[model samples]
Target: MLSPNTTLKQIEILGYLGTKFPNWIGDDSFNNIVDIKLSGSQHCSNLPPLGQLPSLKILHISSFDSVTTVGAEFYGNSSAKKKPFSSLEILIFKNCHYFEALSMSDGQCQELTYLSIYCCRSFVSFPNGGLIAPKLSDLNIYNCPELMWLPEKMTSLSSLKSLTIRSCPLIKAIPEGGLPISLSKLRINYHQLLRIKWNWQTLPNLKNTLSEEGFPTSLSSLSISGCPLLKKIYDTKDSENKEYWRKISHIPHVGGSSERQEEDSFLNMKQAMF
Candidate 1:
């Protein structure tokens, strides 16, 4: 019943707030809300109905444990076909255990630029269609041990610039051809990843390669740590192929005293090398 251009720009819905959402949210009232914080609630089963928000840019959902699923219908009816937040640029979900996966509706989140998920242990895989966000530049996944692999079509992120994955023990390898060619910074840590394979030729200006192995050419800065099995930097075959990766700045291992110290040392070495 509420119209789109309401004066409110930011809203925080807390305890017992779930039942009142559909009525509280205006059709375009949320368009100006760039930041929203939801906490201490239940019953937010799906996002607000579609076409309700045309300008929402950032959304954060935290500490809501009762939500189990999110689907396309939650955004809008099949016939109306509205996107909940077309201008949304940053989305963060934290401490949400019941949420298993998120499948974006068609033509949703076209301007989304960043996504961060933390402590959602039940998540197994990302949504289908690779959830492309043409302006998306950063992704961070942390403490989701159940996540097995990244979306296979991840290279569709043409504007992605930074990616960080930490404490995801089940992930075995980076998705083949998944890394975007426009990527400039990548950091992966605490995953059970055993191999690092990438199309080095596609990433000609990659300035940093931080992992156990498979660094490409033009890697002016490199760091390898937390990998006890990696005794050598490069295989004998690749070592002979010197056209790529003319110099490596730092190489450290987990056998050292502490991870924090080792990472610091690696950074120091990188600074010196550059």
Candidate 2:
């Protein structure tokens, strides 16, 4: 048992084999804790109610193989008036093979600025009504092969600035109603099936747009790979590709296969002449 006078502010437990935590884990004495990370705890079927910790600002959950859903239990049902995750600013879920859905109860994530879901292959989508994070600035989803959609009405996240989706092949488009104009940087890589049919009408403020790996260079706005059809539209000179070019014409950078070819051509010309 932790001492009542304990002022511990951070806790990290990794590779724990316990099926459940001691009841004291949810005690109010942990209210001062600001960060918690539980990783590689393969036997734990459920997570401790770390949300009850009033000062918690960051949480990272990884490789919890048995946990399938994060539901009301995560918010601590001890009281109706409690506001869980009220101060959380960053949350990450990684390599949870069985994690399928995330459902919140009385939690408030308005202060959450960074959220990431990585390598959770079984994660399908958020629960209905979706996560509500009004202040989220950066969201990254990587290698979540089964993810079907982004959070509902993501346009409501007016403060969102960066969104990166990599290797989430199932996500066909952005969330309904399109992304907020506040978004400045967007990256979607290895989405072979993404149809590029999103509403580009509201993205006048988007400073940086889609690319494969790194930030598009000063001359690049969009870089695509594993998208042959888009490449065709870009390479061919015809009337049919006009709309396709128009969709991305507003972006003001350049880095992609075309740039690579230009570099190769320059090298070849130098070698042939010299």
TM-score, one value per model = 0.73, 0.75
lDDT by candidate, in order shown: 0.64, 0.71
Task: Give, for candidate 2, the lowest lDDT window spanning 10 residues.
Answer: 211-220
Lowest-sum lDDT 10-residue window in model 1: 249-258
Write candidate 1's Cα lDDT for 77-123 as tens digits.
Answer: 45545555677888888888877887775577888899998888887
- Candidate 2 TM-score, C-alpha based: 0.75
Q: lDDT for model 2, on a 0 to 1 scale? A: 0.71
**Candidate 2, 82-164: lDDT as tens digits:** 67787999999999999999885324666889999889989997857766888889998888899878888877778888887
